[model samples]
Target: MVEFTDWDIFRNLALAARWTVLLSIIAFIGGGVVAGILLLLRMTKNVLLVGLVRVYTEVFQGTPLLMQLFLAFFGLSLLGIDIGAWTAASLAMTLFTSAYLCEIWRGCIDSLPKGQWEASRTLGLNYFQTMRYVIVPQSVRVATAPTMGFSVQVVKNTALASIIGFVELTKAGTMLNNATFEPFKVFSLVALFYFAICYPLTRYSKYLERKLNVAG
Candidate 1:
């Protein structure tokens, strides 16, 4: 068996963690864009469009993300569309993230007083104008804390990408453990790395919740 010093493992894992962070950022941003479009469509009050958005959200949110990753990685091959592990993982993560964020943002928008809509209408603002000038601005504050909290989930979820052969922190740990036969030490460090990345976001999420007085 090849020997791996603790420092060697740490160094390799830290390098791999950069990919984890990058994947999470890409997925989260892509998801936000998709979620924003869905939110706007739902806001249009078109029954068909709203129902479609609801079904999309339910389909993604109700299913296991692991299954989604598998499908993204394997299913496309059946249709003759080739994709690498990174592409598949990014696609799956973006779709999964979009579903939950859409709901979170929708709930925030709905929580606002109905009178704001009425008042905006009285001022002769159309649906788009009212949303842009009034609803969206107010809802942003309510959404910020929860959005940050969801970002932590996005980061943790990147580990699932390892199942498809993405060389992320978890995958690196697994590779190192296999090489050195040190699952305990390797995985403990892996968990510590994840905690190091996630804990600050978790704490900051709580801080925002408290500061915004939006805590449940």
Candidate 2:
């Protein structure tokens, strides 16, 4: 049996954590782009576009992320498109993050006063123009804190990507544990690493929430 030292485990876990961070950033940014488009659709009065966006949000948000990953990884394989774990993980996380972000931004848009929309229209602004210039600018204050908070979720959720053989932090920890037969120490350290990464963002989100309230 091989005995893994703390340094060895830490080294491997830290290495894999970079991929975790990378994937989270990819997912968050990609999701933000998609969510922004969806937000626009929801704000518009087009019934067909609105219904399609609503269904997209519901389908992504309604399902378990694990199932999404599995379907992306395995289901695609059945269709003769040999997908890698990285692509599947990114695709699933992007979709998952997009749904929640759309909802978050939608809430922010809805929280805007009715008079703002009327006032924008009175100034000869169409829906897109109003959103671009008036509504979104004001809603930034409401959206910032929640968006930051959701980023913490994005980081944590990257762990699920490990299930599909992506060699991220959690997957690295499992491999190290398998070699050392030390699940408790390995997982505890893994948890601590996640905490170290996520705690500051969580705290900053809270701080922004308080600051936004004071500013308002």
Task: TM-score each candidate.
Answer: 0.96, 0.96
For candidate 1, lDDT tens digit of each residue in 1-216? 567888999999999999999999999999999999999988876899999999999999999999999999999987899999999999999999999999999999999999999999999999889988999988998999999999999999999999999999999999998899889999999999999999999999989989888544
Candidate of highest TM-score: 1
Clash tally, candidates in order: 0, 0
CA lDDT of each prediction against the hidden true structure: 0.94, 0.93
Worst 10 residues of 1 by lDDT: 207-216
Whole-model lDDT, model 2: 0.93
Residue pairs in clash, model 1 = none
The Cα error of candidate 2 at residue 116, in Å, is 0.5
**Position 178, candidate 2: lDDT:** 86
Q: Look at candidate 2 and give me any clashing residue pairs.
A: none
Which residue runs of candidate 1 sit more than 4 Å off their true CA positions? Answer: 214-216
